[model samples]
Target chain A: MALTIAIHSYKGGSGKTSFAINLASAYASVGKSVCLLDVDLKAPSSFNYLLPEAKHWVNDIFEGRYGVMDVVKDVSKEMGTKGAFYVGYSNPDIVAVRGISSKDRKWQSKALKLLMTAKRDLSNAGIDIVILDTGAGVDFTSVNAIAVADYVISVGRPGASRQRLMEQVIGGVYMPLDKDCYIIENMCHNDNPTDLSGKKFDLPVLASIPCMCDVAVRCDNEVLVLTEPDHAFSKKIYDIMESLDKITS
Target chain B: MTDNSSTEEMIRLLREISGKLDRILIQGSADNESDDGILDVLDVMTLLTLPDHLRTTATALFELGSATADELAERTNKERAVESNYLNQLVRMGHVAKNRKGRKVYFSIGEGLGK
Candidate 1:
């Protein structure tokens, strides 16, 4: 089976989705079978960035209208890269998000189980890595997704308030999870992690990625790692990919 | 419902899923999922449940990625005679694959419903 990874954060706008896509691309570049799931059911972003015309979304997976395999879009050919690369999108329509995450206890549990089955089914299809770009902050779907994951890479920004919030989350929310959890401080002014780390947060900071216009400009449309594998931002992302490869399978 | 042992296995599968769902509620964290219970609903059940022998064999094979009959026998805790029959039936059912090397055979999960 494959290792499940959740790109999560306690704060919004931490670039978790961007990191997840690039990391997935990096893994696929190495001939590893990978799938990037846009499971942020509350607010979908990957479709806007990668495939705006996606017909099947993660919403269909939750609605039980489609199996995980049915909705999987093979992005490897579009990526113009090697290995198997797939993307499962989430419905960007307001109605879909409302229905998926609305106040219905029964529906929520069933939906969570379906998502778990989705990952399991994907692994059954010989995918070596499954990465979920979950919603920011503590949400039911995010927690359930993380619970089923084997490894978690929590992304955060470099700020006093965000740092404090993360410290609380790492202990309160993320600590109890019995999985290999790591942190990434994104949007750093410089590459120096020690300087950006500031106060000692009680979590393993895996990579400190700098803010680059190169990334921000292309993120709206193209994937930086796929388009420019030798860019500065792409190098840092590879550094993260290499670092994760060592710790995780 | 099919047989006495099969009924017990169905119950076990339900309890396994129900208990896992309960953990989300038990944790009671901000993001922890809450549910009344699986016992209350009839239609909302997810996590496609399989028959007793099929589930034990299929889940073990899918989870382990691949296994030989002997290895699967240990995983599902069945006698060699019984387990071998189960594996062969699964292969014939198109739920599993049988790879042969000399006299040894390795079994892997195949494209079966809910597998």
Candidate 2:
């Protein structure tokens, strides 16, 4: 079974999805069979950042026109055989899918089934890990994705709201599941070092990623982390992967 | 019903019900199993009267069990409390066991539960 890691945060704009894509790509660069699933149905940005191959299978799967595996394309081909990388494509109009009604019980049930199916397909494709990029906030979709993961990587920026959201998620959600959830502070400015420390945020800080405009611009252009490992952001992503390996192993 | 058909149907239903219950459990809802006496009732139900459908599914879930709440949460997208309660019920009923190594609670199917 592939280790399913869900990159999630309760608050938006915390670089959750971007970290998921970059981390998945980083793992792939090290010869790990990795698949990045864009489960953030309302805002599916992983496809735009790491798998902009102009073709995705998400629409096909949603419309009952294709299996999920048909859309798992190798985006790492451009990185020269460093490792295997595949992105599960999603339709840009995925919000229109009938199974996307977050409040509907039928939709929730169907979405869970879809997740399980996606996991099976990804595993069968020899993916060693599946990184799920979840939507922000404590919605049904995010909860369902986190519930089914082997590891929950809570990504957030250092802020009061972000810290509170992390506490709510970890205390109310992850703790019940008894999961090994780790917190990652992204886009940390050097001036604010005590942002997440002390009695306020008691959760372990797995890694801190510095804010890098160049990396953000490249991500906006749909670039992979391995494509520029020497970059500051890429190195930060590499450190996260290493930390994850240490904890998971 | 034929024995084979009944067994299959039971397993199917158990799988669906267990999946549903598993979702609720993963969400970290406070099931009324906190009282030791109530816990005993749940254990009896699980051991004796739990529908065949639920039995099969619960067995499968326990068998392919996660070692940590984090692992289970990562797999199910559920909150920690929900998963803990579900695992607690299983543990109380002797269907699951928790291995405490250092600070972590690793859950797996109990050896007593015939696999």
Candidate 3:
């Protein structure tokens, strides 16, 4: 089975989706077959970021117009990488179903089945890494994504509220799954301390990303770190990805 | 000499009507596609209900997440002229706040907008 990593945050503006997309691009840059899923159904930004180069109809997959494999588009070229990259789109109705009920066992089961189907399809296409960009906050969907993940990268900013929320999310919900979890501090400034060595959180800090203007400008159109490789921000992203590899491997 | 039960019933009826209005506003849909125009006007009318910075930041944050300053800059090739034009629009609309985190200037959706 491919390694599945869910990039999640308890609060919005934490760059969870950006992290997931960059991580997938980074993994693919190293020749790994990668797949990314935008689980933030209400605000599906990945498709907009990865479109033009992205193939495989999202609506087709959701409407049964095409199998999951048929919708797996190649986004590696856009990232300037050699591996294959595909983005999975969520159906609004399914998202509504998941959001509408926490106690609906059937909905949960069906959602899991859909995820598994997606995994199987990607695996068949030789994907080695699966990254899910989960919705912000400790919602039912976020919890479900965490539960199913083999590894969870909790992205957060530097603040007490963010930390407290992270603690609540991990301690109260995800910790029970026993999955390896890492914290990534985004939008870090030069004045801010690094390593978060003694910051006192439930998880260890895997990476601290400095705020990069180039990156902010690029959005999700392409991988900033890969494109700029030598820029300070990109270097940090690369270093973080390397550390993540050590932890996951 | 009004009965208490009748008064309570009247209050309940008003509450139901108010609840319906709230739903309509939240949903932003109805036979009045033009209702959107009216809602915009109402939002402007109630602009005093919130602080100017708060309104600006709220709009900025949503727009930022839907996209981002860095992404916008990249689309325009990091040209200050183009970037300023876009950023100015955000600033004017109160959807983004300008902040300097170091040498790099960052525009984020105003404060307390993160869900």
Q: Which candidate is the best by lDDT?
A: 1
lDDT of 2 by residue, A15-112 (tens): 87778877887898889998887776666674564444646555455444566678767777775536778777555565554446533433353344
The DockQ values of the predictions, listed in order, are: 0.03, 0.03, 0.01
Runs of candidate 3 with Cα error greater than 4 angstroms are A53-67, A91-105, A190-202, B1-115
How well is each residue in A1-249 modelled by candidate 3, as lDDT tens digits? 778888988788887777777777778877888888776655565545454444544444433467767776676665567778777665445554454444333333234435555666666667788898888886545665665577888888877656767777776555545568888899887665434456554368887787766676685666665676777766776788788778777
TM-score of each: 0.67, 0.65, 0.60
Q: In model 3 chain A, which range of ten residues has the least summed lDDT?
A: A102-111
TM-score of chain A of 2: 0.86
True contacts kept of 1: 0.03
Ranked by lDDT from best down, the candidates are 1, 2, 3
Kindly give the stretch of ten consecutive residues in candidate 3 chain B with the minimal lDDT sum: B39-48
| Model 3, C-alpha of B32: deviation from truth (Å) | 37
Per residue, candidate 2 scores C-alpha lDDT tens digits across B1-105 of 899999999999999999999988966544432332233322212322344333433433532444686666555556767667767767777656678999999
Docking band of candidate 3: incorrect
